[model samples]
Target: MFLNKNRFFSNTDLIGFALLALLIFVMLPVGLDVFRLNLFGKYLTYAFVAIGLVLCWGAGGILSLGQGVFFGLGGYCMAMFLKLEASSPEATKIQSTPGIPDFMDWNQIAEIPFWWQPFHSLTFSLVAVIIIPVIFAFIIGVAMFRRRVGGVYFAIITQAIAAILTILIIGQQGYTGGVNGITDLRTLKGWDIRTDDAKVILYFVNGGLLFACLFIAQIIRKSKLGRILIAMRDQEDRVRFSGYDVANFKIFVFCAGAAFAAVGGAMFTLQVGFMSPSFVGIVPSIEMVIFCAVGGRLSIIGAVYGALLVNLAKTTFSELFPELWLLGLGGLFIAVVLAFPNGLAGIYKDYVEPRIALIFKRKMHIDEDVSKYDPLEAAAD
Candidate 1:
């Protein structure tokens, strides 16, 4: 059991964590150019959603298809702050409204909206990034889970919510920046984020955030709560009959997942420099699920790799064969489901891990034999 003793991480987990740390912190940064590194940083943002999904869907069996909504909410909150900073009176002197965002001016809004006012303060915006999404998730979780909603029905409801939110943003062009989203994000507290140095710095920052989320996921996975979640997933009726409030457990993990996704969304906006309604829509939400599925939903670290590899492939294939990109993505998902149902981590465990372990075992045996035959040990004997 992953919940054995008080160990938060087993031997395999330590190796996974160390290797991921090396790859994300050292190898990738050292190898890739700033542009490609920044791209991976964006990919890492999705990994946050995947990690949360590992807890929500993998453990708690709470599948949320509208995760992109939380992600977008976080990104928009950050974007609002950045946009406000960039929309200074001095900077937008030529506009009709010299102090407000350009989109507001273009849409004939003479003054800043009251809701946008709070975003001027970076602290408020940063806090809102997490809080706003968590609040949304909490509301949804409570409304659905309390009523015994789960599985496909819950997923559909979330998906519908994502669509509705997307439509609302698109309709409220003046407020939400419509389909184009909040763009021209320039600085973070007067520091220009467009520079190469800032991009690299942000990439490392993104990597750090990812590991933080991963650690939290691992804690939950190894704790009693994690075991409970698993039991609830497999035998919900029995667990509920045992005096546990299944709905409450589901809500907790779901909200936690939303919070993780929101953080990712905020980091994404900081790195990518924009937040659009397109990202808040159903398609992106489903893609986020695909990221989790491909990575091995049961494994937190594997989800990170899944996010990176899938996004990397998307970038590569989209540029090379634009027409076939969607098909390829769909096909990949099908293959993962049909063949390697457990995703990349499952593949590693089933085939790759055993071979590696066998080689290590052989090496250990050889070392023992050599030590026993050593001239010094033999003479002593």
Candidate 2:
């Protein structure tokens, strides 16, 4: 049902996908130690959010700046379960409440909250990671899109929601983790997640999940729905007059972005050992948008690279420059936006692809002219 008839993705996309797979799964894993690989794994989680943005903002023209809300929700869901495991009666003998999370105890909560009790089950926690965020997205989508609320208004609303959620998390210190967030997450179903071997395994899991999301994004991009999204992005009135419910489409994509963010959040908690309000706020959400924009939001694969490069620069420059790091990053983002609005993907499209065709021309013995194939060009004729 989801198969594409060789539609959107051409050889260019296939090659892009292959190269990314090789780098994330093969090259990086082999070259870097477990510590460095885990750091990259953290960055890859951000790629999930960036890919979601490709569909929401890039294809559908829905710019949601509150993606961190979903990401944090997902991470917190996973963290809830892990914290329960780590807060077993034996482990929390020091606490007043023998089986409650440390934060809950610190806040003087006497019993595990009913909502949190369900997360003690791994199955429920796993489902909640994706389902909860998607549900929230659905409500927001319906409220906004049904009312024809969009453009910058929608963006502002999402950003405001991120702020509200962050405040809520911090205010409800007993139930949520407050400013420190959920911490000391240990073991997943009795497997020690803090070990070096466990970190490597989790890194691979993160990479595998990223590919799954990327493939799903490609399939959506190449399908009929994807085309409709593009059309709607460009000419909404025309699509609305053509007997399609545009609001539903926007809602679906927005919710889908939330779901992707949820998975990333869950992976982040596993790899980073914590989930905090710091990740669920306005600043991180804006940074997520930066990831999508810098990556060339139109290209899912480019989003992944963008997340890696931006984060790589973040880690490297912050360590080296410390005080000057923010200035450097701001300058870099400004440079990319002003000089190369299309971003890394746009650069490749204009410069790298033509060169590739030139290189292949030498290899093809009887080729007069051959294109790698661009869908938009074909569509114009």
Per lDDT, the best of the predicted structures is 2
Q: Write the per-residue lDDT of candidate 1 for residues 250-333, one digit (tens) a residue.
A: 999998999999999999999999999998899999999999989987788889999998999999999999999999998988
CA shift at 183, candidate 1, in angstroms? 0.4
List, residue by residue over 162-277, the lDDT tens digit for candidate 2: 99999999999999989999999889999999999999999999999999999899888887888889889999999999999999999999998999999999999999999999
- Candidates in order have lDDT scores of 0.89, 0.91
Could you say which candidate leads in TM-score? 2
Q: Which ten residues in a row have the lowest lDDT in candidate 2?
A: 372-381
Clash count, predicted structure 2: 0
Give me the runs in candidate 1 sitting further than 4 Å from their true place: 1-6, 366-381
Candidate 2: misplaced stretches above 4 Å? 1-5, 366-381
Cα deviation at 4, candidate 2, in Å, is: 11
